[model samples]
Target chain A: MIKVKKEFILKYGVPSLAVIIVAIQLCLVHFQDLSRWKGGGFGMYTEIHYFYNQIHVSGMSVDSLIKDDPSMRSTLGYLMLMPNDKNIKKAAELVLKTTHKDSVYLQIWKPIVNSENGLYKKVLANEIHLKKSEL
Target chain B: MNYWSAIEIKLKDQIALASQLLLFMLGSYVFILAEEHKLWKILVLFFGLIAWLFFRNKTKHPIIWIVFFVLLTIDLFYSYFWVANHHFMLVFMVLSVILFSYHKQSDILLKNIQLLLVIVLLASVMQKITSKQFMSGDFYYHAINLGGLFKFFFTIFPESLEIAKSNSESLTTLKELNPNLTEHIVLKDVFPNLSFVSRVFAWLTVIFEFLVAVAILWKPKKIGTHIIFIILLFGILFTRLETGFVSLLAISGLYLCKNIKLKLLYVLIILGCITLIITKFGYH
Candidate 1:
């Protein structure tokens, strides 16, 4: 029995963990708008949507707000890569705190290609309208 | 002699050598292109080179492996957003080596490495198949025209370069325009039959990846399996110069390889990958 347990663990342990991780990654990709190229799904180069997605902020001066704050820059970078609700909310809150604004508008845009006519366009993948009190 | 004991004794030297090579590969990757954290890069390079040179008996220096593993894990979490898939594989590979260092079991380590290769490839294949853009070949089409790693395709079809330039200009214009404007720019494709070519490339990618995964799982120790891996590596390198990933795959292949000639080839590939990285070839 001990030998069997050892064999099973030795053979199946890491691979099983890998499968579970992949499953979680798929969920993130499906629901949370996580880029297929990230989170260890081995989904690199599978789609035109890459980690270079753009984050747009409205109703505030992003440059003046993030110029001195390295942490906000890093947070925005993460938000570009993963623009899920949580990251969007986090970024919105940061904007609200920095600019002393009542609310901020944030949108994540990903480049997409229309196959029929080869038209290139940026589509909104996620958006958030968060107020100061919403945090 | 007991079966596992004999097997361990037989593979003892080879596993040590494999561990050293993997450490070197990991170190080189971090030093060259990975590890956005500067302090971690220096530490990994220092310890990796030290371990590679002086630590002949890896079991005696468990702390080094532990430190290396911990550093890689920290980096993985720190830069999780931008980290490549191969970076994750590197962490898992180090973990397997750490396990081997503890248990002194070569077979388990080999099995784990084999399984890693299979799972990664299968997952890649699954992702490609399930993605609508990939199946329709739009992804490859965009990549080839966008001029990163797929710029080599321009040599075959020179007119696509002009199209790519136009596309770039249009995309730049589009970006500069109002964000709320729902305008679509029609990207030009002047290269003849480029769509068909992209479809062929996409299908070939899926088929080759699936075949390589099956080959590795079917015969972990056979020369044929190694050949398939080499073919896949070259296939990917031709279009996309993923030197880090190529070296990682070669290191895992080396762990399972017993033949001297193939083993030498794997080492050469790893060194070649390092050289490619140093030269800044295909670096975007």
Candidate 2:
């Protein structure tokens, strides 16, 4: 019985854990707009939605904002890479603290293709409007 | 000892050696990446390499594996949002090796790695199949035309470089003007049948990934299975230049592979990936 249990754990344990992780990542991708390129779903480059997705902060480009405040680069990058609400709100709050703005508007823009004409366009994937009071 | 027992011991030793070499190479490559330049990361990499070089045989110590695994876990948590998918795979691979070192179970480690390869490939195929952009070939179309991931193709299709540059400029303009604007910029194709080519490549990716997964699961020891995996690895290396991911896949392949010649080839591929990574010739 011990040998059988050992064999089963050796054979099935890690792979089963991997499967569960993949399932959760799939759900996150489908529901939370997490990029297929991330979160270890092993789905890199399956879609155009990647880290290249743009994050706009109060109508300012993330790059421009970084130029203005270099310290926020990492936080902004985190937000841009995965624009889910938690990251979005965190980034918005950071911008609020750094820039001392009354309210912060954060929007994530992702590239999409019009299949009929093969034209590429940027579409809003997610957005958040945060007031200092909310935080 | 009996002959069979002797052979088993020899094989187990080989597995240990292969795992040590592969992990050392992976650590070196990861440390060399620009994003991994933090002081603590450098110190961990330095200590790991020093221990590996001078006390190569001592790496079988479970404590060493545990230390590396713990540091890697910390790094992953610190950069969770920005960490690549392969980084996660690396962590698990290290964990498996740690288990092997602790329990002295080569079979379990090999089985775990084989299962990992199968699952990752199958998951990739599932994602590609489910993605509307991938199915419509739009993803590959943009990838080839934009020229970062598939930039190696520009050497063969020189005209594609010009198209990529033009497309980049247009996209930049559109972004600079107004991201929320509904204007769609029509992209130029490098060739008359670019769309068809992209579609064919996209479908081929799905088919090859699916075949490789099935092959690994069905007959991992077969030479034919190894050949298909080699083909898939080289195919992705040229097109995507994902040296880190490719090297990880090859290491896992090496762990499951029994044939001597294929093992050598996997070693060579891993070395080539390291060279590519160090030179920044391809994506890390």
Candidate 3:
């Protein structure tokens, strides 16, 4: 008779199962591109706050940004607000990239981007204190 | 021992001493998760609490499993992907504890907790390594920049927001060419030397995360291991408050400690964690 030690199950079986489950879930989410799926556009508070900040910092009026690429006005707010949710951030980035490709607007407002494997996510705010010497 | 004999041996420790503590921890977690709900979640926690107090170590009771199963069912219905992943594992482990009737499988139960700690820590290491921004340090850089700790400092001084706003403006202009820039831009005046320091902190976090994962697998018997756990726990406590669930895993490490003195110390650490959790939650 084959003897199965309790230690074997605890040490290997359960943990392995957990890892496998997470891996599968992550894969499904990424391949489905669920992060980029359009949701209800940003609420008013998000719109006004981000637009004002952009205008203040870059000297690019919100009117110009909207006129050049209307999609950007809807997506920029999410880049600033939803930094932690990787999928939502990715979706927001996808919208911005599509709308402002090769434009100076793209240069002036870049969301912090992080990629793992094939998945990419963006965050607001970049490192401001690093010197050329450090890089 | 044969398979059957192993099962028989596992049944010997009929009472799991920490079952009450586990119930309290998991119950409180569920209550917090479902705090905004009407009555279903609250009633479940209330019943679970009553059962826990009345039957602390009576792990063999069928009613206990039923209550837990009901909780699990409700949790599944409400489980969204955004709910931190650890909470799912907590629910699973809690159910397993109830089902195994730690009264009958105390040793196995302890092993379950240990396995949980190892898996969580190891997966975290993998996530960091796989994340390109984490390796390049940009992820950490921005995370810290936008994190609660950074905002908390500004909250107290309020005067510093001007410097922060000015620094942020300049930083945005520097990234016009590349949205995914990993390198940092030097601040003009206030905290002039901090960008590199932030980068170093970022790398340190990854290293610390990797080390803690290894410590759990190494069994954390030595004082050095305990210190690593402490540094990581308190470090997150201040930097990234959201990951505070790790405190429970540290408490779970007590199961692996060889000596009574160390176990007592682990208990005290758990108390400290509970107090911190209360403070954060209450304030929120």
Candidate 4:
């Protein structure tokens, strides 16, 4: 071997290095655990919830709210009372982070604007949390 | 002309190169492809619902949203709260329902979809960036409401369901099984009401997303970023908890992973993986 070293290894001698590199990735993925690799910090599951929950916590259900209809679901009150699940909290948190005070404004309008009845001006109607002053 | 042209070309190349470097370093498109079918369903139902809304006036036209919305709600609860899988089945269901319903109003459906998708993606990014979080703070509450991943685990691996139609021996196994096992617990359940975990998770998600965006916008140097990208894009792939793998591929194709060649390849690979994901996980 010393008398006739292979030209293949001489020209493409990175086999050992390649093996080391691949082994490193495999070992790291398996053991080193760098970059939080698969951990949940900004993981896939977290983002999935972000979008899925968007429909529920938004001012009204898409079917009813997009067209400004109030009959199908509550604008704010009942939905607010609806169990705030982990998904809702995530959607709300996204809304809060993205909109800041705008979230509060829109969140308030959820009930006010949702009433099918002319309850926006009414003192006591289906949705009770609204005050004229707030409006 | 010679020197200036060369310099201009080099500058353009460098800007493209810099963008590539930025996107490459970022973990672009985390959950974008992991729960593809489910994401597709979410995308489909999202658009179908819009289409359904466009024809909501038809009254005669029917949308069995009860089933779809139930799935959507379930997925939302799981992804945000519990662990979600098989979201792609929902995707197919939505697509199949709306496949041939193309009509005059379909253009309106398309326009609304285009506009809303932009808003959703931007809102998603904005939530990630401004708050120094990956997603949003509301995530924890959503997770709790859905009972987090544990609920899904129970749904899939129920003690009662495991027994055969009439296996008396199954009853003994049920008694031996401890429903109170914390090993099956998700992080949300572990830290039940802790708001900070969501906040922390949100911030981390944003940072990772920004990194991914950087990778998406990257320009290919010699070998290009695909090799690096596969390694990097997986910031979302390995977790595989929320969205289907295809959603991640689609998002990466549309935005974050800008190198077209790599993006296309990523989409194809994830699409191929769809069936495997579906049968193994069951649709959320």
Per-candidate alpha-carbon RMSD to the true structure: 5.3, 4.5, 12.3, 22.4
Candidate 1 residue-wise lDDT, A12-97, digit = tens: 78878788878888888888877788898999999865544667787555566679899898888778767788888888888888
Cα error, residue B259 of model 1, in Å, equals 3.6
lDDT, candidate 1, B171-277, per-residue tens:
77776555677667787775657678788888999999999899999998899989989988888888888988888888888888887677777778877886776
Candidate 3 CAPRI classification by DockQ:
incorrect
Task: Give the DockQ ranking, best first.
Answer: 1, 2, 3, 4
Predictions' DockQ, in order: 0.66, 0.65, 0.10, 0.02
Which portions of model 3 miss their true places by more than 4 Å?
A: A2-7, A10-13, A28-30, A33-110, A113-135, B1-19, B36-59, B62-73, B99-103, B150-162, B165-190, B242-244, B281-284
Over the stretch B1-284, how does candidate 3's per-residue lDDT look in tens digits? Answer: 49756644433322342354455555555555565444776787688779877886766675655666576557556543334555556555665566465335556666666666766666566555554445565544443333324556666765565666765666556444243444545433223344465557656766787787687667656667767776776675566454336546555656555544445555565556655565665211
How far in Å is the alpha carbon of B50 misplaced in model 2?
Answer: 9.7
Model 2 lDDT tens row, A1-135: 998898778667778877887898899888877778888888888888565577776656666668856568877777666778888888888889977778988888888875446688888878999998887
Tens digit of lDDT per residue, candidate 2, span B78-124? 76646778877877788778767666777788888889889999999
Alpha-carbon runs more than 4 Å astray in model 4: A1-126, A129-135, B1-123, B130-200, B220-233, B237-269, B276-284
Model 1's chain B yields a TM-score of 0.83
Better of 2 and 4 by DockQ: 2
* Model 2, C-alpha of A20: deviation from truth (Å): 3.1
RMSD of 1: 5.3
Q: Between the candidate structures 2 and 4, which one is better when assessed by lDDT?
A: 2
Q: Which number leads on DockQ?
A: 1
